[model samples]
Target: MMSKSNKMLDVQAMDTSSNTVLSVRHLKTYFYPDDGSVRKAVDDVSFDVQRGRICCLIGESGSGKSATAMSIINLVDRPGKVTGGNVLFGGRDLLTLDTKQLRTVRGASIGMIFQEPMHSLDPVFTIGEQIVETILAHEDVPRVEAAERAVTWLKRVELPNPEAIMTAYPHELSGGMLQRAMIAIALCCGPKLLIADEPTTALDVTVQAQILRLLVRLKDEIGLSILLITHDLGVVAETADDVLVMYDGHIVERGPVEAVFDRPQHPYTKALLLTRPIIGQKLRRLPTLHEVMREVDDGEIAQPKDWSTLATTVQTDGDKGEAHSTDANGNDHDSTPILTVRHLSKYFERVHGLKGEGNVKKAVDDVSFDVHRGETVGLVGESGSGKTTTGQTVLRLHSKTAGEVLFDGIDVFALNNRKLAKLRTRMQYVFQDPYSALNPRLKIGFAIGEALLHHKLATKRDVMDKVVETLELCGMDSSCVNRYPHEFSGGQRQRIVIARAMALQPEFVVADEPVSALDVSIQAEIINLFSELQHRKNVSFLFISHDLSVVEHICSSILVMHHGRITERGTVDDVFNHPKDDYTKSLLDSIPASNPKYRKIGR
Candidate 1:
C-alpha cells in the first residue's frame, strides 16, 4: 500500500514535474432551504485525482458522492450551493474561478459523463452532431475536423460503425450505445479529468461490465484521471485505485482501494459489505427496510465478525471474483417443489410493416423450472431475454401459449374464470418500479388493504387493522397509512407494494426485479424481508433480476435466460460454479467484483 508521505510526494511530483489533473479539498456543498437550515449535500469531503488514477466514491443513494462530483464540474443546479471547498486543477483553485472561467474549464480542461445518458443527450440532435458541437465549442476547429474527431472518439469508445452511430439520434441507439456515445462526446476534447457518475446503473450486467472495461482501457490509453461516483462496490473494486466510502454526506472512510475493501473499519462500510450479494452464499432472508432503518437509527453495524474476514478476502483487481458462502446456521431445511412449470412456451403474433407476418415470437421458449416451498428461484437474464415474460406467464398474467403451470399439483391454465380469480389470490406480483405499479391517488392503507378486501380475507371493520398489521410486517409504520406513494422514497414505496402483494397471504409471488431500482443497503433489507416472509408464510418466489450477485445469495435455484430460452438452470451452486452454456458463462463474467485483489480475468 502507498504510504501518506509517498502519496503526498507523488502528488507534488505530478503538479510540479508532470500533471496533477484535479485536487479537491474540504469540499462542503449544501442545499439551502427557504427557511434557515441547510441540507449538507457534500459535507467536508476531501479527495484528489492524480493523472491517470481512478478514484471511486462508493455509497448509498443519499450519500452525497454524486453531489461532490457535480460541484467539481460547477454543475450543481439551483438550491444547491458550493458553500465551502477548494477545487484545484493544475495547481489553480477552480472554486475561486468565475462563471466564464468555469465554462472554459468545463469540457476543455475537464469532462463529465452524466448518470443517465438517455436524458443527457438530446433526442432531436444526431449523436455525431452533438459530439461535433462539443468539440467545436471548446476547440477552434472547422465542421469537417469536428466531424472527423467525433467519429474517431466514437470508435475510441469501441462503438461499432462509428460513422453510422454518429448520424443516428440518441433514441435510435440502444441504452449501451447511447452511454458509449455520451462517453465518446466527453472524450472528444481529451480533458485531463473525467467525472463518471453511475455510468452503468441502468444497463444490463453484461453491458455494465463491457462499459467498465472500456472506461478502464480508455483511462490507461489517454492517461486521464477519473472521479467515479457510484453505489456499486463491484465497479469500484475493479477500477478504483483508491476509494472514499461516503455515508450521509460524509466521507466515513478513505484509503487505498485494497486497504479500504480488504479491511473496512467503519460500521457503515461493514454493513454495506454484508448487504451485497455474492456467489455461493445462501441467504435465509434479506433485511427489511424497517429492520435496516432501525439499525441505522440505533447506529448498529454488521452482525457477525466472520463477515469482516470475507470482506477482506474478496478479490477486487478482477471483473469476476470468487465468492465464499458463510452459513451462520448449520440447520438444513426441507426443500420440496411448490410451483412447477413444465415446458412452458409463450408466443405473440407479430405485425411487421404492411403485412401481418405469421411470426410467432416465442417469449419463454420450452422453459421448465420449479420453486421449492419457502425457497426463492432466481431468474437471471438481460432485457428482452424473456426473464420478465417467464415470471408473468408463470403467474398467468399473460396466457401461456403452450405447456403447464402447476401450483401445488393443480394446473393454473386449466382453471375457469372464477377458479382463476380464486387461484390469482394464491399468487402475487411485485413489480420493478413501485411508483408506477402503485396507484398515486390511493392512500397506503387502501392500497395494501385492497388485496385483503378483494380476496375476502377480512371484513370492512377489520380491514384497517389488517392493513396496519401488513404494513408493520413489511417494515413500515401505521403512520404511513394516509401517505401517498410519491411521498415515500423508492425503497419505501417498494415495501408498500410488497405489503400489498403479501397481504392476502399468497402461496407464491413473482418478484420481478423488486430491488433493482433500490440502493445497496435498501436492497439488503428487502432481501432479508423476503427471506423472513418466505419462512413465516411458507411462500415461494420466482425472483427475476439482471443482478446475478443478488440472485446468488437469495435464490436456491437459478435460471439463465438468453434470447427467449433457458440457457442454464440448476441449483445456485451448480450453475455459478460450473456453468455449461457459453451464455451463462458470459453472464457470470459480467458480474462486477467487489474485491479488487483478484485480477480481472474472464471466468
Candidate 2:
C-alpha cells in the first residue's frame, strides 16, 4: 500500500484536467535576511484552483497567504527566493519560466489585484490613461480603440459617469471608485486566473458588497478562476467555493466552504471564526486568540478558557462604572456632556473645468452632536460622507468653515494659538493608518513619550517610565520601546499608536478607523483594550469607522452621516435593530453574513 503522504499527492495529481486551471505543488519561499537566519514565508504549500471557481486562502496577517500568491507568479521580491516546488499552468511550470517569458503570462493570462490601489496605480496618470495602457499592453489595439474599451470596462464594473471617471485621476475618486477601477484594469485583459489580495479590506460595507457581487458576476459570465487571499472569514464564507486555511506558512486545513465553516477541524480555524464580531450577538467581552489557544513547547495547542469565569471576573472588578449606565433610549440622562458641536460646517474651494471658477464643497454641513463623558459615540458613513472630517473638526485639526465647538463648556473656536496649543494635551486623535501615523525613523519609545515630554507631562528622567507604563496598558512591554515602527507587525504598530494617544491621558480621543485594517483576532484585542481604557480612565471617544458591526459592539450610541449631514442618531440597540433611515438600513444589510448557509445570493 502507498504511504499516506504519497496517497495525498496521488489524489492531487489526479485532479489535473482542463477543469483545473492552475496547480501549486509543494511550493517553498524563504526569505534570507542579514541576520543569517532564514524565514520560511511559504513552505510546502500545495493547492489547485478549478476553472470558474473561487478558492479563498484565509488566515491572519503574516500567515504566508500573500507569499504563496506572489510565489505562484514568480513575483517574490529580492531577499526572498522561491527555493523549491512547481507552479503548473497551461502545460508550463511558471517557476522555471524566464523573466521575459513570465512577463507574457502575467498580464495576458493571469491578472492580480493588489491590496492598496493608490500604491498599485500610477499617481501622475489619469484613471483612463492607466486602464487604456493596460489594455494596449496585452492587445494589438489602437490608442483610440483602447480608450473606448477602457470606458466600457469601467461601465461594466458599475462605475457611474464613466466619462468623468476616465478624466479623473486616482486621487479624485473615492475609495470605492478606486477599487472598482482596479478591478476594471485587472479584468480588462480577460485573464484565465485572477488573484485578489484583500481587495475589500479597506472599503465600507456597501462598497464591499458591490465589489463582491461584481467578482461573482465576472466569475459566472467569463468562467474566471479566482485565488482570493484575505483575513476576513465573513468574506470567505460568502464568496468562496473552497477554503484553504493557512497558519505559520503551512496549509493546515482544506475543504469546501460549507464544510470548513460548518465543522472546522483546525483549532486556528475555529479560533478565527469565533473572534469575529457577530452582528446580532452582543457579548460582554469579545473572545481573543489567546483565550482560545495557548502556546506549547513544540508548537501551539487549542485550550479554550472558560468564558463564564472571565465574564464573572470582569463584572466583579466593577470597571464598567457609568459607561454601562443607560436608560431605555441608550442615553445617560444624568451625566453631563463633555463635548458639544453646534451648527458645525467645513467647506473647501475648488476650481473646476479649467475655468478657474470657484466652487464650494461642503465636507461637513451643519453637523451638530454631543459626546458624553465616559461614552463612545460612533460616527459612521461611506467614504466622502464626512465622518473623518467631523472627527478632525471636533479636535480642531481643521479650522471650521462655520459654527462652534464647545469642550468642557469652553468655546474651542474662540481659543487663541497659545491656548489651543495648551488644550491639545487634553484631546488626542488616533489616525486610521498606524504606519503613516508613526514616524518610521523614530523609536517607538520616543514616539510615545515625545508628547509627554513636549507637554511637560514628564521629565527626561521619567519619560521612559511613563512610556513603558502606557505601552503595558496597550498590551505591549518595555522591549518595544527600543524598536522602530518598521520592526513591528501591523497589529503591534497599531498598539503603539494607541499607546501614544493614551500616554497623555486625554479626556477625549478621536479614533478614525482604528481597527479597520486589522485581522479579526487583533481587532478583538483592540476593541477589548478600548473598553478597558474607558473603564479605567473614563475617557470619551468619537470612534469613526465604516464598519457597522464593530461600531455596534463598542459604542453606546451612533450618528449616521450622508453627503456631509447627519441623517440618523440613536442608541446602539435602537439604531441597529430598528434603523429608521434608508441609508442606515442599507449599511446594515451590506454586512457579510458570518455563516455560509445564510449568505445572500445574486445582486
Candidate 3:
C-alpha cells in the first residue's frame, strides 16, 4: 500500500519544474457581512490539478466549491477577498502577479465553463461574435480567421448547424445549444487548463450526458488538465480521476475516485454516497447530514410517523375513494385512474421581426397519459421536451390549445372559471425553484394556511393547526411555522413548499423538478418523505423531472418524452430494464451510475 503522503498528489514535487497544472495550498476566502462578523466561505482548502487528469470538487451550495474555483481565478469581488493562499500555475504564483500579467494568463493559459451559460453569454451579441472576441483578446488572430475558428470549435463540440447557430443570439438558441456555444468560447483560445463549474447542472439528462461526453473527449483530444466543480456525484463518478469532497468550507475528503468511493473514510463522504438514489438499491428513509455527522444535525430535523396508518385514514375517511373504487359487479377496482389527459396540446406564438405574423411553437404536442390513484407517475425528459408544459396544461395552469383533461371523471377543460377554481382544491402544483415558490414577506404559517382557508377547508382559528399538521406530515414541526422562507435552507424551504401543496389535501399534484437543486442528502430526505406520503395519504403524484436516477427511485410508472411527444411509457422495470425507443435508451444511458465499479471507460 502507498504511504499517507503518497495517497494524494504532492505539490512539493512541482518544484518549479513538475507537470502540475495548478496547485492551491491553505487557501482562505472570507466575507465581512453587515452584522460585523467574518464568514469563511473557503477555509484551509488544498488541492491539485495534474496534467491531463480530471480532478473534481463535489459539494452542496455554500460548501465553498464555487468560491474555491473563483479564488483560483482571482475573481472574488468586493466584500469578499482571498485572505491567504498560494496558487501556483506553471511555477508562477498567481497572487503575486500584477493585473496585466494575470490578464495575459487568464484566457491564454486557462479556460472556464460556468454553470449557467446564458448568464455568461452576452444577450445582445451573436454566438460567433463572442467567440471571436475571446480569440482576439488572447491571440493576434484576424477577424476572419477567428470567425472560422469559432465555427470550427462549434462543430468540434458536435453542435448541429454550427454556422447557423453562430449567427443567432443567446435567446434564439436552446439550452444545450447555448452550452455548446459557451464551450466553443472557452476553448477558442486553446488553453491548457479547463475549469468547469457545474457545467451540466441545468441541462436535461440527454444534453447533460452529451456535455459530459464532450468534456471527457476534449480532455483526451487536447491532453489538458481539468478542474471540475459540481454537487452531482454521478458526474464525478463518471468524469473524475481524483475527487475532493467539501463541507462547511473544509476539504473533508480527498483521494482517487475509486479509492474514495470504494472506501469512504469521512462521515460526510459516506453519508453523501449513501444518500444518492441508486438504480435498484432503495432505502427506507434518506437521513440528513446531521444524522451522519453529529455536529451539523442541530437535533431538530423532523422524523416521519407511520405512513401506513396515514393512508388508512385517507381511504376510510374520504367518501370519494369508495365511490371511485367500485366496479359494476360490486367488486373493488382500487387502481382507478385519478387524472386522465388525452391528446393534450399547448402552443405559444412567437413574434418575428417586430411586426410580421407570428410563428406557433408547439410546447406540448398531442400528449396523453393516465395517473392512477396512489401511484406515482414520472414524466421524464430533457429540457424543452415539453414535460413541464404537459403538466401545466393538464393542471390548467396554462390554457391548453387543444385536447381534454379529466380529473376524477370531471372534464377539467370544459369547466367554467368558478368550477375550475373549485376543482383546483383537489389538484395542486409544486414549482421547481423553492426559493421563489413561497412569498418572501409571508410567514411559513401564512404561506401554508392560505391554501387551507382559500379552499374553505379550515377556519381562521384552525388554519395554524392545519398548517402545523401538514408541516408535521412533511417532516417539519409547528416551530417552523413562525419562520420565513429566507431563514430556511434549500431543503427546508422545499419542505415548506411541499407542506403548502399538501395543505389542501389534494388528491393529485404536479411536482416539477422538486429536488433537482438540493444536495443528495436532502434529496433523499425529500424522496423518503414522498414515499411515506404516497403510502400513507395515497396521494397520486405527476412527478416531472429531468433526472432519470431520481425519477427511477420514486416513480412507479415512467413516461419518456422528447420533442414534445411521449416516446415511451411503462413500469420502472419494463422501461429501464428493456428500453424500446432511442430517446428512452439515451436517457437511461445518461444516468451516471452512483457506484464507481460501474464507471464506464472513455466516458
Candidate 4:
C-alpha cells in the first residue's frame, strides 16, 4: 500500500521533435533515511526542454522540482540516489557519464546558476578568479586570456563596472549584482543549456524583472535553452514557453505556458494559480492544496471565483480597518490613529576608507507615517530604501536621531530602557529572516509560549493551551510543538515565527518581510491570516515588503519610500492605479502579473 501510494502520477506526452536540448524519461530519485523509510523525491518525472526555449518546473517546497534538475546534472548527494532515469542531453546519455566525463561536459555543455549566490560564491576568492577557474576548467586557455573572457562575459550580462567587480569579493556586492556575477560565471564557458534554480528569488521586483529580461535576451540572442526551476508562477508566466507542474515527486501536468495557465488540467495546478494574489483584487481565504486534492473525484473543475467579490464582504464589515476601526461594542468604526510617527529620522556614522572622519548616512530621513486602529499600513521599497530601518526605529530597536513616535497618544521615544522593555509586549516585531530570527536551541512550543510566560499574559496552567491555539491559528499542527526550529521547512518556520508574535497578542505588529520566503499559496494563507487576526484582535500592522501584490492585498493604505524618505502615501487603489511619484510608478511597473493572457506573454 505504501508503494502504491508512492506511485508516480501520469504525465502527458510532450509535443516536441528531435531538437530537444535536455530530455529526462522515467526519472526516479529516492532517498534512504535512517529510519528505514524511502522518500521518493523525484518519481517518474519526464519532460523535454526544447532548444532556445525556457521550461519552468514550479511547485511548493519539497515537491521534487529541484530534485529533477539535480538528477539531470547527476548532482544528487549523500543517501539520495537516482535509481532509474535517462538524461538525454545533446543526443548523449548524461547518466552514463562518469565523473571525469561529467566534469568536462558540465561547464562547457551545461551551465548552472544556483539559487543562493552567497552560498555558491567563494568569499575567500575574488569573482574574477572564480570565473576564470570555471572557464579554464572547460577550455585550454591561458590565465590572462581566461581572465579577459571572464570580464567580457560580465559585461555581456550588463554589469556597470566589470573590471572593478572582478577584483571585489562576493560580500562587497549587492544581492542583484552578485546574481549577475553568478550568471556571468555560468555563461562564461558559453554553454548551450543553462539551468537556473530560483535565480531571482531573493531580488526585489525591479531587479527580478531585469534578471528575467536578461535571461530572455540571452535565450534569444545566444540560442540558449534554459531549464528554469522556480515556484513563482508570475515569473513562469512572463518567462516560460512551456510549463511543468510538479507535486509530491511527480509531474502532474505539462503544456504550453498559456494553455497550462489559462486552463490548468490538474487540480494542483489550478490550486497554485488561484493562490496567486491579484494586484487589485482581495481574498477572504486562499485556496489550499487540500481543497484542490479533495475535489479531484469531481468530473469537471470550474474556474476560480473572483476574490474581489468575496473580499468585499470581508472588507464591508468584517475586515474593515480603514482610517478607523469598529468600537468594542461591535457598532460603528472610529477614525482615531493607533500609532503615529512624525518626522522620524535615523542616521549612521560611516567612515571613509583609510579616513577616520564620519560620513553621515541617513537611513530613515524624516519618514512620517501612521497606523490606524486595526489597520494595515504597508511600507514598501527596494532594498536599502529604509523600509526595515523605519519599522525598527519605530519599535525603538535603534536610537532615533530625530522625530516623535506616538503610540495611542503616548510618546514612545521618551521611554527609558526599562519602561521600553516592559512596553515591548504591546508592540512586537517579526523579523525578516525567520531562519535567523528564531532561537535554534528552543523547542517550537517553548519558543511561542516564551513571550506569554515572560509577560505573564497567561498563567502556567493555561500557557500550553494558548500556545497550541496560536499554533493552530497559524496553520501549524499541534504535533509540531515538540519540534525544533531546524526540523521545519522555510514556510513552516515562518509560520512558527508568526505564531510566536501572535502569542503576545500585541495591539500592534511590525512584520518585516514576513512572507517573502514563502510560495504563492503559503504567502496567501499567511496574509489572509494576518487580516483575520487584525479583525478579531483589533491589532494594527506595519507590513514591510518589496512584494507589491501582497501589499495591495492586505494593506488598506501604502507608504512609498525612496532614498530614506516617504515619497507618496495613499490608498491601495489610488497609489496603484494613479501614482504621483516617479519611484512609485516604477515600482508598480516592475510588478509581474500572473495573468497568462497578458500582452507580453512569454516575452
Candidate 5:
C-alpha cells in the first residue's frame, strides 16, 4: 500500500539521521515585563532532536525546558517573544514561518501532548469528536475513517472499551483515561515528531509507567522522533537516547543517556541526580537550591554577580524553615499524629457492561493512615490506588463514605460547616499545578493575603506586610507583591503557592505531589523548603506522590497503597530495607536506574 518513492524517502531520512530532524541554535525567548526589561526565558540555548532517537530536554522549573518546547511549536503567545535563533526542522527554518505556514505543519509534522489532560480537553466535546477533528484538520479524511482510526489508536494506548470511551466527554473519564485520550488525539495526525511536556506528571506510578511504555512502543514501531521535556531523571534513563541538560536557559551538558547519568560532567546535573530521593536513601531533608547553587558557585566555576546576588537573597529570608518533626532517631519524623484516618473508604458508580448494571468502584477501600505533627507522611501508589482520593478525603474535599478523619484529634468529618471553616485556617493544601490552583485574577499579594483576610489574622496594613513576608519566606522578594501568577515563572508560581500555604502558619498541610510538577532541581529546592518549614513551623504533612524517590527523600514514614488498600506502612528505612509487601518490592524494583553500558539499544 506504500509508494516506493515515499518508502525510499523514509529510509533515506533514517540513514541521514545525523543531519538532525530538529536543530535549535542560539535560541532566545524573552518576556517583556511591564517594567520594560526582558525576562530572557530561554537564552542562547542550542540542542538537536534527531529523526529516530528520543532527545530529552531536562531542567528544573524555570530553567526554560518547557519554554523551548512551546517555542518549537510556535505556541509562545504575546508578551513572550522569540527574540533570536533558528528552529530548524527538516532543513527548513521554523522561526521564519508565518501563521499559515506554521499551522500547516503544526499537528501534521509535530504532535503535542500537554502536561495536564484535564485542562487540555474541551469540556463540551466527546473524546472521539476531538480526535476526529484533529485528524480532519490536517487531512480531508472521511468522518467514518477518522473515527475508526481514533478507536484503534485509543485501544493501542491500552484504553478499555474504545467505543465507549469515544462517546464519553473528558469529564466522564478518569485522569488516566483522559491522558490516554489526549495521546490518541495527538497521534491521530500521524506526526513525524511528538513533543511530550511532562505528560506523566499528573498520573500515578503504574499509570505513568504504562504511558511511558506506550510512547516507547509507538516510537519503535513508527520511528517517530520524540522530544521529552521532563525533570524526572528516571524517565530519561528509561526512554531517552540522548539527554540535554538545561540550567538557567542554557544547555550545560548533552550526551548519550547512559553517559550523562553515569559520568555527569556538569555539577548541576550531578547534584540533581543525587539530591533526588531514591529507594535506599533515608527520608532526610535534602539541601536547598540555594545550597546547591552555592556549591556550584564555589566549586570550579566562579560566581557571576547576578547569581551571587540571587543566592544571597535566597539565604537571608527566602527559606521558610523545616516542616518535619524529629523522630526518636533524631531524624525528621513527626510522631504527634496531627491527622489520623481510620478505615476510610470512598466509592464511585461505574457502568459495568452493555447490560448497564452499574457496579460500585471502591476507590479508597478501608484505607487508614496517620500524619504526625511536624512530620511528613508519604502516600504513594498507582493511579487507581486512590492516593489523591485519600488526600482529598482527609481534606474533606471528598466526603468519606465511611470512617473517621481526625485533625489534631478533632473529628474532621464530624465538624459542623462553621467549625470546619474555622478548622480550615490551620490546614492547607498545595496542588500539583500552581496555574490551575491559583486565582489568575488576583495579584500574588492578594492571593496569598486572602487567607489572612478570611481568617481575620491581620489588618489591612498587616495584610500587605504579611504578603511581603510570606513571599520572602517562600524564596521570593517583596517586589513580586503586585505581580500576577502569569507574570511569574513556573518555579516562582510554585513558590507563591508555598507562600500562600504558609500564610496561616497551619499546623497541618497536604502537599499533593507539589514537586512532581517541578524540574529536579526545583523539586529539590521545594522539598528543602518543606523541610525547613516543618522544622521552623512544626507543621505535619500528608505528602502524596507517585514518585518513590521523592517520597523517600521527604517522608519520615511511608504508606504504600495498592488497589485502595494500605499494602505496607513503615519508616523510610524499614520499608526500603525490608519491603515486606511484594507489591512494594515490585514498585521499588521498577524504577529506572542509570542504564548499563553497551546494553542492547532497543530491548
Candidate 6:
C-alpha cells in the first residue's frame, strides 16, 4: 500500500529538478466582486506535470480547476487575481515575470486550447491567418515561412485539405474542424507544455475520440506535457498518467490514475466516480454527489442503507417490464406511436460569392422514425447528422422542406397558425443550451408562467403556485421562483428549463442535448428526473444526443442518424448489444471506458 504522502504527490518529497515540466505550488486565485466579497477560486492548490506525461485535473464546475490552470500561466483576468503562487517552468518563476516576459513564455513554452474554439479563435480572421499570427508573435520568422509552417502544423494535426482549411474562416469550419484549427494554432510554435481546458466537452463522441487520439499522438511525437482540465472521469481514466481531484478550491486528492480510480482515498473522489452513469450498469436511479457525500465516513464514502434498492430494477415504471422489447417489424405494437416522422427533410440554400447562384444543402434528407408513448426514443448521431434539425422540424420550430410530421395522428406541418399554437400545448422542445433557451431578463417564475398564461392554461392568480409546484417536482426549491436565470448554476438552470417544459404538461417532448453541458453528477440527476417524470406522467420523448452511454441508460429504443438519414433503428438491447450499422458500432466504440485498465489503445 502506498503511503498518504506518496499518493498525494508531495512536491517537497519529489525530485522536481529534472522530470517536472511545470510545477505549481500553493496557488491561490481569489475573485473580488463589486459587493466586496472575496471568493477563493483556487486556494492552496499544488501539482506537478511530469515531462511528456498527461496530468488530468478532474472536478465539477466552480471547483477551481480552470482557475488553477489560468493562474499557472499568469492569465487570471481582472477582478480575479492570483493572490499567491509559484509557477516554475524551465527553472523560471512565471509569476515573477512581467507582462512582456510572460507573453514570450506563454505561446513559446506553453500553449493553451480553450473549451470553445469558436470563441477562442478570432471570428474575423481566417484559420491560416490566425496560426501564422501566433507563430509571428513568438518567433522572428518571415511571413511566407510562417504561412508554410501553419499549413504543416495543420497537416500534423491530421486535418484534411490543410491548404483549404488555412484559407477558410473559423465559421466556415465545423466544430471538430475548428477545434483542430485551434490545436494547430496552439502547437504551431512547438510549445513544450499544453493546457487543454475541456477541449472535447461540446463535441460529438466520435469527434471527441479523434481529438483525444490526436492529443496522445502529439504528446508522443513532440514530447509535450499536458495539463488536461475537465469534469469528465472517463477522459481522465482513458488518457491521464496522473490524476488531480479538485473540490471547491482545494486539491482533494492526487495520485496515479490507476491508484486514484481503483482505490480513491477522498470521499469526493469516490462520489464523483460512483455518480457517473456507466454504459452497461443500468440502475433505477443514479446516486447523486449530495447523496454520496451525505453518507461519508471519515475520508471514505459509505453507501446509504437504500443504495441496494436503487440498483434492483433496471426498468422504470414507464417501461412496464417491456424494456428493450420490440415487435417483429421493429415497431411498438402495444400502442400507436405518439410522434411519427415520415420522409422528413430540411434544406438550406447557400448563395455563394454574390453570384446569385444558390446551392441547396440537405441538412435532413428522407429521415423517418417513430416515438411510442411512455417511451424514450433516442436519436444518436454526430454533430451535423441532422438530429437537432429533425427535432425542430417536428416541433415546427423549423419549417420542413418536405415530408410529414404526425403528432397523435394530426399532421403538424399542415396546421394553420391558430391550430399550430394550440398543438404547441401538447408538444414542447427542450433546447440544447439551457441558458440561451431562457429569457435572461425574466425571473424564473415569469419565464415559466408566461407560457402557461399566454396559452390560457393557468390563471394569473394561480400561475405562481403552479410554477412553484413544477419547480419542486423537478428537484428544486419553491424559493427558486423569485430568482433570475443568471443566479443559478448550469444544472439548476437545466432543472428550471425542464420545469418550464413540464409546466405545460405536454404529452411529447423533443429534448435536444439537454444534459450535454452539465457535470456528470448533475447529468445523473437530470436523467433520473426524466425517468421519474416519464414514470409519473407516461409522456413520450424524442431524446437527441451524441452521448451513447447516456442514451443506452435512459432510452428504450434508438435510431442511428448519419448524413440526415436513419441508417438503423431498433430496441436498445439489439442496437447496443449487436449494432448492425457500421456508424453505430463506431459511435459505441468511441465512448471512453471509465476504467483505465480497459482504455482503448489507438484510433
Among all windows of 10 consecutive residues in model 3, the one with the lowest summed lDDT is 324-333
TM-score of each: 0.88, 0.90, 0.89, 0.92, 0.77, 0.92
Please identify which of the two predictions, 2 or 4, would achieve the higher TM-score against the true structure: 4
lDDT of 2 at 134: 89
**Runs in model 1 with CA error above 4 Å?**
1-19, 34-37, 283-305, 308-337, 349-361, 414-416, 601-603
| lDDT of model number 4 | 0.83
Give one digit per residue, the lDDT tens place, for model 1 in 34-97: 8888899888766667788888988888879888888887778878999897888866888888
* Model 2 misplaced stretches (Cα beyond 4 Å): 1-14, 123-129, 141-151, 163-169, 295-334, 352-356, 601-603
Misplaced by over 4 Å in model 4 are 1-16, 295-300, 304-333, 352-358, 599-603
Instruction: State the lDDT of candidate 4 residue by residue for 1-603, as single tens digits.
Output: 113224434455654576788888889999998899999999887889998999899998899988888899999996899999799887788999999999988888999998899999999999999999999888998999999999999998999899998999999999999999999999988898999999999999999988888898999989999999999988988899888888889888888887887777666777688667777665545444444344433433555453333323323223242422222222222468889899999999988676687789999999877888877888999999999999999998999999999998878988887888778888989887897988899999988887898888888899889999999877788998898999998878888888898888788999999999888877866776787777768888899999998888778788999989999999877899999999998898888866666624334
Q: Rank the candidates by TM-score, best first.
A: 6, 4, 2, 3, 1, 5
- Taking all chains together, the TM-score of candidate 3 against the true structure is 0.89
Candidates 4 and 6 compared by lDDT, better number: 6
lDDT of 5 by residue, 176-266 (tens): 7888898898888888889999998777666676788788889898888999998877778788888888877777778888777776666
- RMSD value for candidate 5: 8.2
User: Measured by TM-score, how close is model 5 to the native structure?
Assistant: 0.77
- Candidate 5 steric clashes: 15
Query: Residue 43: error of model 5 in Å?
Result: 4.1
lDDT score, candidate 6, position 176: 91
Q: Model 1, residue 467: what's the lDDT?
A: 91
Error of 3 at 55 (Å): 0.4
